[model samples]
Target: MSALAAGQRTLSGHLLAWALGALAALWLGFVVVGFRTGQHEADELTDGHLASVAALLLSEATNDFADPRRVIPTSDGDNLRAHDYQQSLSVVVWDAGGHLISRTGDAPLPPFAIAEGFATLELGTPAVPWRSFARWRAPAHDRRVMVLLSVAERDDLAWDIGTQVAEPGLWGLPVVALVLGLAIRRGLRPLDALSAEVLALDVQRAAPLQPRLRHQEFEAVVRAIDTLVARYHAALAREQQLASELAHELRTPLASLSLHARLLRGKTADEAERQQSLQRIEQDALRAGQLLGQLLTLARASRTELAEAAQPFDLAALARRVVAEYAQAALDARHELVVEAPPSWGLSGHPVLMELALRNLIDNALAHTPPGTSIAVQLDAGERWLQVCDDGALAAQKPAPAPAAQGAAARHALGLGLGHRVIDKVAAVHGGRFEQRPAPAGFSTCYRISLP
Candidate 1:
C-alpha cells in the first residue's frame, strides 16, 4: 500500500507541497517581523505617553501649589475598559524640599527613589513590575513628577494588537491552499490528457500523435514522442522486410540443394552429370549459408547499444586484417584486391560491427561484379572516411544511387543489397553516413562510409 501510494504521487502533489512550504515560511517571517514591530512600537508609545503626561501635569501646576489639573484620562463614560485593557497609568509628585505633594490614578504612587529617566519598579504583594519615567519641572526645579506603566499591561497591548492584524491571514490559509491545489491540478490536466493519448497508441500502426496543446513544453514533448514512435515503426518495418527477404531468398537455394542432392543419389547418375550436380549442390549450400549469415549480421548492426560501448582500435590495422582474411576469396574469384591506408589510424567504434561492414562491402563487390575486377579498399585517415571501389561492368551499369525503395526486393533490385544495407546500419550506429559516388578513373563506383 505504501509503495502504491508513493507511486501514485503526482506532479501536482509535489508542486502544491513546495508552494505550501514557501507560504508557511513567508507567514513565519511575517509573524516574526510583525511581533517585533508591534512590541517596539508599544514600548515607544508608552514611553512618550509618560513623558507627555508628566510635562502636562507640571505645566498645569500653580506657583502657590493650591490645585493641579487632572491629565489622567482613566474615567471612561461607562466605567468599563476595552477588552484586554487592564492597567491605568500611575502618577506621583514631590517637592524639591523632600515633601510629598499629589498622586493620582489606580496604580500605587511611584517611589521617590525613581531616577530622572525610565526605571522599573516592584509594587504590591507579589511585586508586579511597572515601567516609570520621572522628571522635574523646567525652570522652577522645585517639583518633580513620575508616571508608572505596568510591564504586563504594555506586553498584552502589543501582542493583542498584532494578533488581531494577523488573525485573518491565519484563518484564510485553508482557503488559499484550496485555491492553490485546485490551480495546480487544473494546470496539470494537459499531462493527463497526453498520457491517455500515448496509452491509446497502437504498435501495429504508425499514426502520428496530434498536438492537443499549444504549451511550449507539451509541444516539445509531443515532438519527441512523435520522433520516437516514427523510429520504432521504421525499425519494425525494416525487421519485417528483412524476415520476408530472408524467407524468399532461402527457398531457391534450399530447393536447388535438395534437387541436386537427389540427382546425385539417384541410380541413373553419370560421372559428368554427378560432378555437375555435386558442384551445383555446393553452390546452393553456400548461397543458403550466406543468406543466413546476412540476416544475423544485419540484426547485430541494427543494435544501438554497440555504438555506446565503442572502444578505441587501430582502424588502419583492422582494415588490413579484414582484407588479408578475404585475400583467398578474392583470388578464387579471379579479382585483384588492394588496400590503401596509413600504417595506423586511431578511432573509436564498434570494431566487430565495423569488421562485418568491411567484409560485406568486399564480398558484395566481388560477388556482384565480373571476374578479374580490380577492387581497392582505401581509407582516408585525414577525412575519417573509407571506401571499397571496383572497376567492374556491374558498377558501371548501375548508377551511383538508384531510386529510393521501401521493400527489400526493391532495394535488392536497386543495388542496395543486404550487404550494403548492413553497411548503412553500421555507419549510422557509428554516427556516420554511407554513400555511393563515382569511382576513380580506374574504378566504376565507390561505396564509402564517413565518420564525424
Candidate 2:
C-alpha cells in the first residue's frame, strides 16, 4: 500500500488493534507458561513415584524376602485399571549376575547399558519405550532394582493438566474483545459530537463555539477555529464599510460637476463667466477622477498574488525617480520638490505597490497644503524607512494649495479618511505601515512608511 493509504485507518481502529493485540499476546504467554509448568511438574512427580517404587522393592528384598522369585504386588494393581496404573508403575528387581529376580507382567526388560539414575530407553524383545530409574541394593546383597513407567501415558497426563488450566481464558477471549470494542467507541463519542457541531455552524453568522466538555486535547483546536471566525467577521465588516464610504466620497465632486453645468446652461452668460465655470467644472472632474484612481490603487494593492512578488531594488533610486516625475507640476505650483538619500540604499519590496504608495503620499501633500510648500522625500537605509515631509500653509492663513498642487500625493496623515485607508492598504501590502506627524524641523507635516 501507498504510505498515505496505510496511514488512513481511524483512530479507533488503531486503538483497538493495539489494545486487543497486546491482550492476545498476554493471553498466549499465560497459556505457554501454564503448559510448560504443568509438563515440568508432571515429570517431577512421575519420576519421584518411580524412585519410590524402586526403594520399596529393594527395602523388602533386603529385609524380608529370602527368595527373589516372589512377585511384589503394587498398592493399586489391576483393579485400578481406570487409573491406568498398569501403564504407570512397572518394577523389575535383578541379581548382580544379570539374572532377573522378579518382574511385573507388563514390564519391559532391564536396560542393558546402565544401572543407575533416570534414563529413557527401549528394552525387551520388541523394544517398547520406557522411562526408567535404577538403583543397586547395598553391597552386601549384590542385587539391582529398576523401575519403569510408560512415556506416552505420562505425556497424556501432562497435556490434560495444561488444557484444563488454559481452557477458561480461551473461551473468554470473545467476551473480552466485545467489551473492549464498546469501551473504545464510547470514549470517542465526544470528538464525534464536536465534529457535528463544526459542520452545522453558519459561517455567515459565525459565533464562538462554546466548549461542551472540558477536554484539554481539543481546547487548542476550538480556540483556533474561533480566532479564524473572528477575522472573517472583520473582513466582512471592512468590505461593507468600503462600499458606503466610496459612495459618500464620490457625491461631492459629482454634485459640483452638475452645478457648473447649470451655471453655463444659458446663452446670456458672458465669455469670462463661461470660462470660469468651465475651469471649475474641469477641476471638479479632475477631483472625481483622482478619487476613483485612489480606489483603484487600493484594490490593486490588496491583491494576494502581488504580495509574493517582492524583488530587490534601490529605494533611494525609486524615491528620486518619483520626485523627478512630479518635478514639472511642483515647479508649476511654485513648490520645492527634493529627494534626500544615500547613493544606492538597497531594499526588498513589491516595486509596483511601492510606486503607487509614493504617488499617493506625494499627491496628498500637493492637494492638502498651500503653494510654496517644500516637499522633501526622505529615505533611511539603516532603519528601512521612507518619508515624505511637506511644509504646511503658513500660520497667517490656512488656504488650499493651487491646482498644480491638487493632483497627486495622498497624505497618510490625519483628516483625509479615504486617503488614509488607501495608504494603509498600500502599506499593509508592503508589510509596512505609514505614519504622519508634525515635522521635526524645517517642515510642518511628515508622512513616513516603515518596513521591517
Candidate 3:
C-alpha cells in the first residue's frame, strides 16, 4: 500500500467524536446546574410557605380566643378544608401557659421549645431527619403555632421539579446526536470527493489537482497533493526517457559485435584478420558493458539509492582516487592527467555516487578532447566543488544537440549526456548543482555537492 493509503484517517470520525463530546459536556453541565438550582428554589418556597402558614395559624388562634364560638377546628375534615397542602402538612396551637389549644394531622411533636418566629425541628437521626416551623403570637404573646413537614417529602418534591426541568434535554439528546452526525458528515463531503478524485488518478498521466474545491480548509491539502502528483509524473517521465536512451545506446554496440562475430565465424584465410575480428568483438562487448554500467549508475542516482548509503568520507581523497583510476586511460590516449587538491578534508555523502560523478566528468573530458590535450582534476574542499578541465579545441565547442535517443556514452562523446544528468541529480540530492562554464585554457565542468 502507498504511504498515503496507510496513513489515512476518517475526517467524519474525528468531527463526530468532538461534536458528541462537546454536546455531552454541555448537557452534563446544564443538568448539574439545573438540578442544584431547582432543589434550592424548592427549598426556599417550601420554607417560606411553612413560615407563612405558622404565622397565619397563630393569628387564627388569637382570633379564636377573642371569640370562643369560632375557636380553631381540631377535626381533620375541617383542617383539610382550611388548607390545600394540608395533606403534606400538620398544624398545632398552644396557649401561652403551655396548654394545648388545638391540633391537626398525624405530625410528630416539636423536638425543641416553640420559638417566636421560624425554626427547624429535627425529630430523628441526621440520616432520616424531619423538619418543622414554629411561630408565637407577637402582640398578645399568649399563643404559639407550629407547622411540620418531612425532609424526605420535601426532597422528593425538589427532585420532581429538577427532573421536570431536565426532561426535555435528556429525551432530546439522541435526536441532537443524530443531527450532529449528519452535519459532520455533510461538512466532510468535500474530503470524500477529493479522495475519490485521488483514487481515480492515473499515476502515468497524473496532473495537478484543480482548485474547484469549495472549502477553504482543504485548499492547502489539495495543493500539496497536486505538487506530489506532479513530482511522481516527472519521475516517471525521467525513467521512461532513461529506458529509451539505454535502448538506443545498446543498439550500435550490439550491431558492431554481431558483425564482428559473423566475420570471425566466416573463417578468413588470414589469421591476422581473424584476430582483429575477435578483438573488435571484444572491444564492442566492452563498450556495451561500460555503457550499461554507466546507465545503471545513473538509474541508481535517479532513484536516490546512493543518498541512502551516504556516509562521511574525505572529499579530497575521493577526488585523488578518481583521478588515479583515469590516469592509465589518460596515458593510453597520450593526454596529461593532473590532480590538484587538499591532502584531506571530510564530507558526508554517498562515496559511490561521488566517484561515479567524478569518473563521468573525467571520461567526458578524455573522450571529447584530443590525444595531446592536458586535463586537470581539481577539488575544492572548502567550496565542496570538483572540476574537470581539458585544454582541447573541442572543449571550447558547444555540445551537440541531444539525440532523440540519449545515453551517458553518447552524451560524453558530445560533451553532455546522461552522465552529466546523473551528476546533476547527485548534486541536487546533496543540496547543490552541477555547472558547466568556460575555463582559462578551454572549458571546465564542475559538480558542487554542498555539505550541511
List the candidates ranked by TM-score, beginning with the highest.
1, 3, 2
Q: Rank the candidates by lDDT, best first.
A: 1, 2, 3
Which candidate number maximizes lDDT? 1
Q: State the C-alpha lDDT per candidate.
A: 0.78, 0.75, 0.71
**What are the root-mean-square deviations of the candidates from the true structure over C-alphas?**
7.2, 7.4, 7.4
lDDT of 2 by residue, 17-125 (tens): 9999999999889878877787788778788888888888877734333344655544445564556333457777767777777676356566544759899888767
The true-versus-predicted C-alpha distance at residue 38 of model 2, in Å, is 4.2
Give every collision pair in model 2: 360-410, 362-409, 363-408, 363-409, 364-409, 364-410, 364-411
lDDT of 3 by residue, 57-80 (tens): 765733353332233334435445
Residue 375 of candidate 1: its Cα lDDT? 93
Question: For candidate 2, what is the lDDT?
Answer: 0.75
- Estimate candidate 1's alpha-carbon lDDT, on a 0 to 1 scale: 0.78
Model 1 agreement with the true structure over 60-142: per-residue lDDT tens digits: 75634423354344554566465554457877778887566766665665567667988888887778888898999878788
TM-score of 3: 0.72
Candidate 2 segments exceeding 4 Å error:
1-14, 33-45, 48-87, 95-98, 105-107, 122-129, 136-143, 211-213, 250-452
**Deviation in Å, model 3, residue 318 alpha carbon:** 7.2
Residue 175 lDDT, candidate 3, scale 0-100: 93
